[model samples]
Target: MAIIPRLSTPQTSPDTGPARNNRRGMMWLAADLCFNIWALSIAKSLGVDLPPIQIVLVRALVGLAVLIPFVVWRGGMVRLANPKLQILRTMLSTIAMTGNFFAVAKLPFALFTTVNFTRPLLMMALAALILGERIRAKQWIAGGIGLIGVVIAVDPGSLGATSASGIGALFASVIAGTSAVIILRRMRNEDALTQMIWQTAGLSLTSVLPAIYFWQAPGDHWPILLSIGVLSQTAQFCFMRAHYWAEAGVIAPLGYFSLILSVTVGYFVFDEVPSIGLYLGAVLIIGAALMASHKGKRG
Candidate 1:
């Protein structure tokens, strides 16, 4: 296990140190955004016919196959130590990944993305309660604003009007957010490669049963599945790099970019336009993300 550094305020250092790091961080952030768009595009192309678990299993297996070579090139099987913690992390990640994929498959892309934005707000509360990190008044305020945004986006009155699938997507966001906090905590003692390997492997193993039970042969779906696996792995790798160059607080907010990407893709590809409430909610969520990013910079 490696000790992950705590998030720190950006400080002046000699010779453009902070600036260079920020640039690198932003580059990785951009890469992550692109990767996410690709992943979503693949999901959209696949449509909802294939079982979510089956899709996840295929992606996980392919991701494992892709990553294994890299892991081996890095240092072979020895790169993975601390099997107990690895297993725990993998299980937590599996839940998050499974839930997220299911949501994507079953829900509208824009709505699904909006709900996913709740992760940062949840992270703030989790940090205070579980990590013993101080939560400032501003952050609490931001969290409230973000929650309001989520409500606006979901528009509870429309829950029944809309598909129950949307509600499931929202719930998946909660699970994913909590899982993220756990991953952050564990990251303090784990290498990024080790974390990725175990998480993907866990996803592969856990999804096996569902994939079998609901096994729909790949057919024309092979390409999309492979794309999802590759894109997801790349996005995660870029995210890890971003965090390494910067801090979680700094990089996390950039995740909001996914919403913009998703909305664009949804409109152009599926001819689905977001409602006013959705835009309003998106604004609030983006505001919260900005505030959080600023706080991270100043912390």
Candidate 2:
């Protein structure tokens, strides 16, 4: 029922462009990717019996712990102007995170990364169908090309369909994109750190019950769990700051670099080599991201 104060937009000289900001965003994104790869590999390597929900909950707790000191030092819990919207966004985020963690355990690292980039495609669809936003023929064509990449990556006809983990990745991808939609619609004006912190809190809370129900103590991997928390919290902070410096679309394609890095990690850490389809899928996803960036944002 109440409206938050609107700040005047800053003006930038045309010559300045978004290069500097995009570069900064690139660093933040790369860091996020590294931590992400490390966490996923840790989870898989732990060889524990814990369910994905439990792993996610532990991750949330770790992120919250890392955030608490900063949230206190930087002026304590960021007040929400719209608590209801914030809560809604947090719920969607938890679901997305759950599916993602599950997928990380199920699919190969390179394949998981390939599917994740398809978020742009989902965003394009939501923009067109849900918001009734007008899309150009070029965007649609680009999206189609991206879809082709996804199919090639998953090759779902038989091999993919039967694998629960593979399906989890699909579930996670769509849910993650939906969460992006919620953020774009309602949380656009919120402080990035504040929203992230609160959403993470919500994530921890939402996951607690499920985590408890399926609880399995992360025996012998406590250090790895701690690392997951620290890495994810830092990554989220960097991710927030990155967007502050530039448009999300500008930094979106830089994600391809993460895929490349993930492939390297997959090979060395997981002993997994990318297949031809995986390489092909990466190309399509990157190309689609470039095309989509010309039009909009990442999922």
Candidate 3:
């Protein structure tokens, strides 16, 4: 709840306006990443006992509840420019969210976060295939490097059924998330709040039935579940504000720092020691993501 102060230190004011905003942005980005990992850690705690669908259901319901006051204050929802795309995006997001919860439950936190860094590489392939965007040789090289990193990290030969499924679910979630981003690109005119509202609403609606089927009462764990909701929403808010206030070049690299936080949590909280492969693979993946991000900014 009071994680901001712990995750990030206060930034001193800079002389220039842009410099100040960038510093603010970096701080927010740190908070965003830290908050997200905090939420995931909570989910991992719950995931051992509760079904992933049920966890997803609680998170969506709580997010929607949190947004209700804002929705009312903003004078109801804004008109959507692309309702169909919104529906499609919502469907994809539900898939992504559920998959992510499942992966969090099944995989080691460090591994879960490591594979997530490949989203940029996944997005690059999606952009080429779906958006008809041109992929440069460097982008291809980066993607290949990221892929190798994934293979090494995953270590197909060593995976058990549960870990393998977790990896599979994470990959599905990343692809679905990338597709959702592509849809977001198509609906640039839609209000961000409107999108957030619709997303929470849709995820709750779609997950309700499955969550019911697999439901385990939160019982004594309600507080932890509620915190997951609050942290996720806060993280989303910080994510948006960070990009709004800071240069992409400034914040994009900071996103990778989340892996460090995840690794810390895994080692201490879950006692998951990273193997040499994980560290080696993380290097390639982070390097590839940075290269891909720089190319996108230049393009």
How do all models score by TM-score? Answer: 0.82, 0.83, 0.91
- Model 3 weakest 10-residue run by lDDT: 1-10
Q: Which pairs in model 2 have colliding backbones? A: none
Work out candidate 1's RMSD over C-alphas: 4.9
lDDT: worst 10-residue window of model 2: 1-10
Query: For residues 1-299, could you state the per-residue lDDT of candidate 3 as single tens digits?
Result: 11111243335456643333788899989999999999999999776688888877888988888878777877997668888998999889888988999899899888899999998899888889989999889989999999999998888899999999999999999989889999988888886778888878888988899889989888999899888888898998788778767888878888989889989999999989988898889999999988877745443
Query: Model 1 over residues 231-294: C-alpha lDDT tens digits?
Result: 8777877776676677666566667788888888888887878899999998998788577646
Ranking of all predicted structures according to TM-score, beginning with the best and ending with the worst: 3, 2, 1
TM-score between model 3 and native: 0.91
Error of 3 at 86 (Å): 0.7
Question: Any runs in candidate 2 off by more than 4 Å, and if so which?
Answer: 1-24, 70-78, 158-164, 246-250, 295-299
Query: Candidate 3's error at 76, in angstroms?
Result: 2.3
Q: Which ten contiguous residues of candidate 1 have the minimum total lDDT?
A: 1-10
Query: Cα lDDT of all candidates, in order?
Result: 0.72, 0.71, 0.85
lDDT of 2 at 171: 65
